[model samples]
Target chain A: MLGIDWNFAGCGCGVPQGKDVEVGMRGLLVKDFRFALQNKKMMVMLVVIEAVFLVMQGAGSASFVMGYMMMGCGMLVLATITTDEYNKSMAFLMTLPVRRADYALEKYVFSFLCNLVGFFLAVVPYCVLRPDRVADTLYLAVVIMAVMLMLQMVMLPAQLKYGGERGRMVLLGVFAGGVLMFTWGRKVWERALAGSEGLQEFAARMAEGIKGLDAAVAGIGAVLLCIVCFVISLSVSRRIMEKKEF
Target chain B: MLVKMENVEKRYGDFTLQCSLEVREGYITGLIGANGAGKSTAFKAILGLIHTDAGRVEVLGKNREDFTAADKEELGVVLAESSFNGMLTIKDTAAIMEALYRKFDKDYFYDKCARYGLPVEKPLKDFSTGMNAKFKLLAAMSHEARLLVLDEPTVGLDSVVRRELLDEMRRYMEKDGRAILISSHISSDLEGLCDDLYFIQDGRIQFHEDTDVILSDYAILKVNQKQYGEMDKQYIEYRMKEPFGYALLTKQKQFYLDNYPGIAVEKGNIDDVMLMMTRAEREKKL
Candidate 1:
């Protein structure tokens, strides 16, 4: 038995039978997860990079290493999109029984899972080495995850809209712009704060305000913002996919 | 109708594609066209890949705008390029497809791949062009789809593999109500496989006729200047001037054969009809 069921008993009109069976969003997530699993080399690379970061940074810099590793995982998520475009596999995917909305949803879920796993992997080493800092590490992980999600939210749609090469260039431009703004803004802030005692006092009060803020509320707000970004990004990607031609 | 496109329009800047066609149950419709004749665009519209500017597209009896994932499950598609991710092996692809498509038969897919000499463990990028083409067809066939839409499926395949693929298509049609819509630049492939052929040029369908009618009734008549000018042009669909004479294409071959016994009338294949119809000046009435 080769599992070749060539039964042609039904109306061969190609019309899907009564009440078209819809695969739920969960099925789409599973399919995307399976697709991601196929890239063994990328998974191995992610693990190796995280291990290297963990070892080099050591226990003292656990938060920094974890943040870097989580960000790395986020980059890997974007890589998957670029890889699909480069290989022109999106066309194949579009032909499948999955809707564009499902595809967009899958990307968001898959990328979130990947970043979560990366966060967990980073947390595991820190937990083993610096058990006392577990709570602090968890808080830092939430912040880092939020940042990663926001970055992904921006990058995903741009990649889907522009494709591999142009998308990478656009991502690079965004990164460069962020770095330039950070450096220039830091200098300007330092110059302003150095001359003005009032400004310095205000900055001190702002820092105190941030430190006094409720951690749980801040974490919840960050998560909510990430969710909002995810929804918006998913919608934009779906629209891009709808207009795309093979 | 299995698939229908009514006044489907897609425009990219100045290039506009306006097409209308149909694929009926148990029929194989061939869309024959030149390289950029909008065949792929029409396919994209039918599959709802690209948003059309205007017109209605219905697939499997449902308007394309309303087609759900389950509706798409009954339609198998193979594009001009190998759409498989290059990093994925056949095994991985089968897994992904099984997860995506509820009716996907993994064992049957593997069997078909094995029969086609496609290595199950190798990534698609490692496969040759012919192997990739065969693998795509095999994947499309493994799914028990009622409508199979193939675009340039046999382009890189050798004659033997092509014949085998065509035979497989014939076998696929054995189940009543199954239909296929295939597009190819190679007209000979369609000559033997297609039930009806639609000739497209410059984003418009020039003509559509049954393969039997095309083979039996259509012809290329070779005549000198004087004879071509003197002959009744009523039946001549198109005429192209050659170095030595004029090659005229007519739908009523028997009429020309009966009336002008001296004229050289050759039985028209899909290619001859496409060439003459595309390049020849259109008749005022048609």
Candidate 2:
């Protein structure tokens, strides 16, 4: 007969015990980072391609080139999340000691870290070669990071709510809708500006107003908007994960 | 109890899962059911992977909702499917597990991997189905958790590997306060390992008893039409009609053997019990 012990204690596996939320969060980050790092070959290929693009495009449009490269890095972050879902590994991940909230926190942290790496790789070289473009490159990097964050804000929740295949479909639909709206809005604006002197004058005034605004204040506002989006996206992703069946 | 589900309920469109069972420390509890019999659903509910409509789930003496990361550290879980990312090599997986689990025995994990003939440098995608299953089990066992929740952990492994895994489970249970809740369609695996068994059908538990009692007391009575008509209906748990006669399932095997002079009574295994019970449920509906 098998021995039956009702006691909860005395299971001496020599493992440490205690609930350290920081350690749990760190564990989740490490896991996600390791997962992202497994694509080192792909990252290297992207770096080689970016180097070619930088040399061909020249330093005149360095900020624009760097911003485009960072965008690809951001997409890699999304790809890692999608890959986890595609492999059905999220089920295993959730069973670990980490909470759903921690998983969301780790994704944002991982994405931010990847973006930082991309920024350094792209901007540092340009800054070293052309010191005059430091401020411009820095500003462009921030804007690119903000845009990437917003894109992830939309993608993460959709991916968490739906699986990979359907999630990609949803992302495609959003992108298509945005392109259609942009094209239609641009056409309307052109028609209105061509026909109406008052409307064109108002547009010119708006552009002037934007240019006249303090750069520091605008930067602060952009950072605040990104922070707000990050918080909301994390909350949405957490809720979706909590409700997920598998 | 290491794990407890009290009146747990989950509903998806028309199918409902309503189950309650307990797994005590230092014992192996087997959950036996046919495919799509809500066995997996019950396991998910206990793990809080799915929202339960009503009832409480308690693990390691605390409500599942209140379970902290520390509590989870003491749990080892293996789902029906491969859980590791296929893109990762075994070395990468070991790194992840070491980070995720504080007590993860890295050496033990690698040793098991080597013993199982799994290449550590290759990505998991290169592993065969049986290799993947063994890897998941190895990962779970490497954690030294107090409770192990395994769903179909031995599905794709050969007989030799399956027996080795079962031996490992027995060794795991030898530790005081260690328990396992395992669900599998393979009845023979559970027959030798489980201390208690729970038979689930539709959405509810049809039977929960000690494995010894199930094997010793439960039986199937083969009878002709006249004997079946005369046999007491109270003792028959489930009945299936065949062209020859009827196979009647009953818990009171000794009672029938003593009462009936020469009725064909054969010991019922887990499979026979599940089939007869499910058939009986369907027959009742008809």
Candidate 3:
């Protein structure tokens, strides 16, 4: 799915040839999807939560639903990594025709698909309810997707490093730490700017320099940054998988 | 050789495995050893599940580092304590295997599943220990792998199911260019199954011999202390102080029979060979 065509027939090779790396990765995705589906309670819970939000918030709930489902599905994919660890099955899975890199890459692809599914689920209902706001909803969905992807960039590696249960705690700690630092840093920035004319001029110039850029260029820059973050996250996860032993 | 390990070593605190072995095409090679004898460690090295601290491990004619995903498609592996995710149904496992292995035979897989009485819809966690073993074996074979590295695949299985699995392995070997490296604590299974056997103890290989040679040439000679002293020790390999007197292990069954007709010479099997190799003192002169 990530630039690898699923229709392998054109390659004129079958399992006997075993030349396709993508096929093994496809298998990993299927296994992960199967595991995700096994959590029927979570699936039902997502539906109920969406219905309740829609009823309570009306059309205003579209953004909330989008955020909730994206988080829900992304988390489900992340949890599959832990399921692979259960019964030491991760070792056995590694024995298959998939490389460590492919296994790591598959998680990212699966995560993106889960987020896409969540986006589609939220958008379809919102569009039906408020057809005139389709463009606005799409734009909001893109912004939310970017944020969710950035979160995954942090979360996936954390999950692989700390494991399933502990990884969640680690993610919480990181988020809490980031929030505290941001608040304190903002106060320090304002105080330093107030105390120094030089710093105030530098800060204004920095803001004027960013504001001078075209909106399209800024959007492209943000997208490029997100892609770079994703690639780095995938690399970190691959290293983790390579060093892991049964 | 389909799989080969030479002077391989894996150290875990006090236990370090220094082993060398090979699995040739068309041969079922048995890694015979007691628990913690490093059989699983050696298998893990060959399968690339764990890294070796030193020496070489080559599978499918390539060093593990050079072996790509395509190379792994030709090899199937079963670990001693792990299988497919327990949350999956047999059906789900089949689908995953089909995707993972290019040559996965779903029909043959389902046939084996039915033969082993495995319910396709049931979660693997719900399977009995023996059923799980059967499923693991079936999954490994269903892909038509050229080399199958199995670590204790028959554990938890009863005699009947064990025999059935052996027969399945036999059938698998009927095809040319296929081989299996299996480990187990059950001696009779290896005696009847492996073409050649490597006996390991305390992270080292004690002996490697043809299964037929172990069964035919090896013998355990029970003798009183006086008889033990008087009998020829030229063919003796190991000697243990039994309550009756001294129990001798020798590879020359005919030599003792010819020299002393009255001596008790019991034919050796895998168990006796392992028992002597691990517990009995080596006759250093031999």
For every candidate, what is the interface RMSD in angstroms? 5.2, 5.8, 5.3
Reference-based lDDT, each prediction: 0.80, 0.81, 0.85
Ranking the candidates on lDDT from highest down gives 3, 2, 1
Q: Rank the candidates by TM-score, best first.
A: 3, 2, 1
Per-residue alpha-carbon lDDT of candidate 3 for residues A93-208, written as tens digits (9 for 90 to 100):
87888777677778989999998987787677778878999998888888888899899989998898888889999999999999999999999989998999999899899999
TM-score for predicted model 3 compared with the true structure: 0.93
Tens digit of per-residue lDDT, candidate 3, span B2-43: 988999999999999999999998999999888888888888
- The sequence of per-residue lDDT tens digits that candidate 2 reaches over residues A1-246 is 022221212221112234444556777666667777877887787677667866887677675677777876777767777777756778777778876666666677778888888878778777877688788778777777778778888887887777677988988998999999999999998998999999989999999999999988898988778877877777777667666767
The Cα error of candidate 2 at residue A113, in Å, is 0.5
| lDDT of candidate 1 over A108-193, digit per residue (tens) | 77788888887887788778777888887887787788888888898888888898779979989999999999999999999999
List ranges where model 3 is wrong by over 4 Å: A1-19, A208-215, B282-286
For residues B1-286, write the lDDT of model 1, one tens digit per residue: 9999999898988778999999999999999888888888898888877888999999999888777777788988899864867877888778767766778898889888888889988878888999989988888988799999999999889999999999999999999989999998778889999999888888899899999999999999999988987889999888787887888889999999999999999999998988887777453222
* Model 2, runs deviating above 4 Å: A1-20, A175-209, B229-234, B259-261, B284-286
What CAPRI-style quality would you assign to candidate 1?
Answer: acceptable
TM-score of 1: 0.88
In angstroms, the error of model 1 at B116 is 1.2
By DockQ, the best candidate is: 3
Clashing residue pairs in candidate 3 (N, C-alpha, C atoms within 3 angstroms)? A15-B102
Put down candidate 2 lDDT per residue, B128-244, tens digits, no spaces.
Answer: 989998898888889889999999999988899999999999998888999999998789999999999998888889889898988999998999999988878787888788787
What is the lDDT, from 0 to 100, of the residue A45 in candidate 1?
77
